[model samples]
Target chain A: MDEIIRINHITKEFRVPDRHEGLRGSIRDLFSRSYHTVHAVDDISISIAQGEIVGYLGPNGAGKSTTIKMMAGVLEPTSGEILVNGCVPYKNRTRNAQNIGVVFGQRSQLWWALPLVESFRLLKDIYQITDAQYDEMLALYRSLVDIEPLLHKPVRQMSLGQRTLSDILAAFLHDPKIVFLDEPTIGLDVSMKAKIRTLIHELNRRKNTTVILTTHDMGDVDALCRRIVIIDKGKMLYDNDIEHLKKFFGAYRTLKLRVKGDLSEQAKRIAAELPECSVSANENWISVLVNEDKQKVISVLSQLQKSYDIRDMQLEEISSEDVIKRIYEGGVV
Target chain B: MKRKGFRFYLRIYFKILAQDLKSKMSYRADFIISTVGMIFTNIAGFVSFWIMFRNFPSISGYSYHEMLFLYGFSLLSVTPTQCMLDNNWNLRQQVYSGDFIKYCFRPINLFFYYESEIFDAKGLGQLAFGIGTLVYAWAKLGLAVTPLAVLKLLVFLAGASFVMAALQTAAAASCFWIENSFYVLDLAFRFRDYAKYPITIFSPVFRFIFTYIIPIAFIAYYPGMMVLRPSEVSLLSWLSPLIGAVFFYLAYRFWMYGASKFNSTGS
Candidate 1:
């Protein structure tokens, strides 16, 4: 893989003015203003290679946007260095913008009143895209995304899912070398999520477009990302392949057991017997966290079966929320 | 992406402007009502002057018709700023709503794209009224109407309008820091209407501040002086083109500086 992006010790500090409340405070601020530094992106460094689809994951306000802004040339880092395709993004904005595309799920770049394809044509002009290239990209986008009915509809009238698909099309129509998708599938249904995931994968595979995706949706990470960078509190927690991460914190399973009667006694018994397992009782279900020790699950279930008539037993994979907590707790590196 | 020429970006701006006009047309009744309302607003300014003239011929040395020329000339001078650049008047709303993010992400120039976002055909009424007033005032003044003088007036109005537009843009850019600067803009415009009258009518202190400190006078007063009182127009009036160009650059630079520090309050 060819290195296309190199960020070294980049930190973005915002001097947020700490203004007091009320008219008196505002007057005071005029005379003696005060500000506090918010380290939105603490000193963090990561190099990305061409054609690599990396998931940039973090909780809200964990600095995902700050980093994206820096990379996209929308912002400048307070300290440190960043180079995209051999040029500093903020220093050479137009040059860097030429090779990079960005899709912001919260804000639409599509003209609100224009038909979706008109926005695409407007972008075609902006990018100086040739007719052949435009047709080629349109064909590829059409095959991947089912936005045919939406192409003629105004952006303001389109559903979130349709708009998202259209936004994705506009972002990639220029055939940018790199694409940054910020929460690309947010506020979409399961089917929409799957469609977008397929589109993302197809874009990367067909065009070899490097992608940096920032999303709270784990299904996106699971569906498309081979590697992911996890950030917490303005610092990198883990930067590695998904396989390694899953193996390090080996895929834990959850057993959701519903009992015939009052199940707290048996749940307590299982807790006592399998001390390593995490056990919790909520409503009618007793969710038992079982990992590594296969026999522990069997021993616990047999004990539960003995105590009460086994009404139902469901085994599930560890959830995204739990995985994020584990990363925050430094359980994986 | 391929490297596009200047024409390419102009086409993009045209497309964006077309989209804006179409969007404005979406609410047909609102468009018509707003157009009528704008005409009435423009007419009201003249009406206030007309009512005042009914009581007294003029406030200072000038007469009622001369004041009309002054006021109409000022309106023509501000057409590009207040009318075409109307979006700058409400840019804080866009900043607060995070629509500024569109320009940030696009490959086109931010300033141009931002301006294009609001083509503002709603200004048509004002523009028509302004041109009509200027023609009426010019004919009423009954000057020699030399082509050279006409050319000079056009040039002055053009340069002054550019300055006005630049000032409006600078005000909008301040929102990057102040977050909500419509109040600040309102305050600026409260003093702005005074330019519609002769600056000489005010105290010397106000005259100096509006001329040198804020330079609001240059937008209409000084330029209008070129036609109204050419002898009083000093050698500095020659620098109108230079001042307009430089000031426009500085104002746009100020906008870019603010945008650089912009921590997008994305909702």
Candidate 2:
């Protein structure tokens, strides 16, 4: 519950040269170059505490990376203040870096051609980590995951999942007070994602390490984060626990049907019969959204069954993914 | 974290350099071929000097063998920069690709981390060729082989290498602001060719720029003078170590400025 990160009205703006299109435009631009400002991160503020895994959620080009970069001391905010571990991140980057770890997905921090442990040793030296701390962390890692087989495997040969897992472990090796993971599970498989999520959860629990993860995968958020902060167009839209966010969209129920016949026709019939429900089809499943408050899901399902020979049907509650999708689609803040 | 002492960083530097060398050795054939190719490249430069000497024996009041000494000294002085700081040559590409942000994540000096990422094996070839030429020139010119003289040569080589590394680092750091700083580094490297000959051959203005502005003349020209013509050498020529330290400090400051102003590329 102790405050470890305090961001107050932080804003990061970038001035980019206005480039011209054609050769003549380019030549004209060379003579009188113009520029425009991009508000990559608008005035946003959030306070994070120790031992909390908060999901920093945003769409592509939604300034997720820009915000994470500012928090990591990679970029200085243009306005307002940010204090991590009682120091301004950009002002005291090296000192802040000692207490924080970062994993920028799609970019491996490990030595490309060296064994995984070599990068770890170099990091140990870089962080000036004591031998006891290093060995203890190693022991914890070995217990949680089967990384012994990977200790000597070169980073270049590892699959994407292995590399990402190693990167996450490396970030936590220093026992940093906070770790910023930008899309850590971005391109990982379900099992790999589960493995990484478990690792992050265990580390946060055991070491009391704060975790700030930016990811589009709702599964990642659902599995690891208790609190979720959603941003769009450089603005913070929502910040609360996942349960509260789900409560906001509690009126809707997803009715999934495993149909054997014409999916589109069945979808059309369902939509026509139930004017209040929103319907969509993919492959052999027709998913119809029913507002439970407006009409019970049972009534909607029974009504559709009378018209079409629905092979099978089931109902699902609105997930965090649905809430986020609705928010991104301009539903509500 | 509090800043550690010099010895701590020095230890990390060698550790990372060893790791880098081990990684480079993974592609054994590529390493061997590139190292050999690097030596051949220097040999090709020497062969050009040989052909020119064959025609005129000397171009600027210096004999063929003396120019060899100058060329050998220039190569030896630059080996440190070539071998250690070769990663800077890729700074522009890394910046464009957003790979430069990797340095920001580490709890180490950005410039040191960037430079320590690689140790160019090709510099070994340059070192081998430079030593070979220096020994050959030493025997031919009948220069004294005193222990003090050898020690002094090493001190001068260290200073000259620092100057060259400083210049290259400063040029490469400009990539943080400019679109392509390799062009600026290339321009700096063109001045390196001037160090292969005596500063006396150039006009006074060129001599001034090489000595004052760029200070590349200290790399080989002035230091060569101290070894070849000790009586003719002035007091200024002996300031290679001081000049190197000053230029390195300035360049490091310049690099820090660029790093502060760096606008990382989009993710």
Candidate 3:
């Protein structure tokens, strides 16, 4: 599929007032004006194909939201161009809005005091969605999240999880060609996050939806995004797939072993034997970190298995957070 | 495409209206208290004027009953504008709270979006009180309610409401640039109080500022003058609505200009 969203050298500048401290200065500020220019989104360019779930990751204050707002047509860039589905989002805001679905975390488009279904119906009317299309979309989302029980409940009365679920469903109700999910799982519990991830995955696969997901949670990136884009200080740091990132950092693996008998003695012996490896243990759980180049994971497990019965073991992929942190600290280890 | 566009916006407008009403109704105490407070405010204004007229039979070539009609006309004109433009007053807070961002994604005019955000239940109370005052004053004055007179009243009120709505909306839009527009809106709405009284009561400079610079005096005062006074000089009051329309257009243009500079403040 062709590129559904293309951001070309876009920059957003904000002229913020530099206010002085103290009550006297605040009163003086009422009469005088002083401003400092802030480059909220520096020159950044990106392109995404249809049905691609691109994880737009960044630390806070890195212009991730500025870029998303520009894409979502809620903001205008100071310079350069942005094309979403061949329409300049700022110049053709209403037209671009017709083709885009935007959810800014838990902040919702649903009417707060109305029932969830009432909000959906209002959206249906505003978007001019047909009855058949509305029913199909509602049925499909209901299957994913089971929103039927919550449909009669007012949005203001819902739990955070239920509200976020309803918000995600409302974002896709019109079935826009492209969707922007801004920190969709921010305050959600683990299970709620999993449900949201599943919804995104299913929606993208079934509807060929082009998704741009901005998230701070590494697990969300690991689960839902194949291609990752890391941005910091309003600059693009890296744009590559998970495989490419793992290629450099994935060599080091952590093995979490549950020894049924004598956990600390085995943990001590392993730490003493493998001086290079880091070992930490609880009452029954032993965490053994090993680099494949120095000492293979299989050998470490074999060595541990001889004395201690490995009741259960877990092999963890290097977390996306550590990978990004490593990249930030020492440039793509 | 034209019909579709019109119908689309109209549907969205009512949908937002419905939601606003529901949200207001949910806060039962706030809703009930605000409505009752508005009714009392109009009553106090009427009683204050009644006391003033009771002491002095006339002021500046206007009788007690004529002054009541003038104030009632102003109230009718101002109350609906206050109701319709409630969103404009709240625009500063909306921008601060990031609710303004959602409005940009709608397939509707930005001004239309602001219009839809407004649905004040308190305005119903004000409306009831205003009509009651206007009828009482009209009956006391013993003026005939001719078809032409009724039509004139509506046209002038529409013009007055437009002027008030446009100014308040423009003041709110200024919040996008100024960040806080409490003073600007306060000044705009407070300045409008001059229209409730006769322009002749103020100094020549005040008359010029209100009549020419702001043109609010034309909104209710001059129009009310035409209805109640009806002298040869009162013929000039017939031009109030047209003058109001021009000022309203200018205010809308100012609002759009301010909106173009919006920075979307923060997260």
Q: Pick the candidate with the highest lDDT.
A: 2
Top candidate, metric TM-score: 1
Each prediction's number of clashing residue pairs = 0, 1, 0
Chain B TM, per prediction: 0.91, 0.93, 0.90
- Model 1 over residues A1-333: C-alpha lDDT tens digits? 789899999988787778999999999988998888888889899999999999999888889988988888888888999999989988878778889988888688888888888788888877878999999998887787666899889999988988888888788889998999999999999998999899989999999999999998888999999999988778888899989888855647888998876678767866887777888887788888888545566766786687568788898777766788877876566
- Please rank every candidate by TM-score, starting with the best: 1, 2, 3
Cα deviation at A239, candidate 1, in Å, is: 1.6
User: Which ranges of candidate 3 are over 4 A from the true structure?
Assistant: A18-36, A252-292, A295-321, B1-7, B22-31, B233-236, B264-267
TM-score on alpha carbons, each prediction? 0.92, 0.90, 0.86
Specify the poorest-scoring 10-residue window by lDDT in model 3 chain A.
A317-326
The top-ranked prediction according to DockQ is 2
- lDDT for position A160 in model 2: 96
Which stretches of model 2 miss by more than 4 angstroms? A250-275, A278-288, A296-298, A301-322, A328-333, B146-148, B202-215, B234-240, B264-267
RMSD list, candidates in order: 2.9, 3.2, 5.0
On lDDT, the stronger of 2 and 3 is 2
Q: On residues B77-176, what C-alpha lDDT tens digit does candidate 2 reach at each position?
A: 9999998898889989988797777778887788888888888879988998999999899889999999988987888778888888898888888888
TM-score of chain A of 2: 0.89
TM-score of chain A of each: 0.89, 0.89, 0.80
Give the alpha carbon lDDT tens digit for every residue of B1-267 in model 1. Answer: 455578767777777777777767888998899888888888898898789889988778887777877787777777777656676776787777766666787666777767776666756776787788778877887865899889989888887777777677777788988966987677666666887777778899998888777777777777877877787787656667568778888988988777766643323
Cα displacement (Å) at residue B194, model 1: 1.4
TM-score, model 1 to reference: 0.92
Model 3 root-mean-square deviation: 5.0
TM-score of 2: 0.90
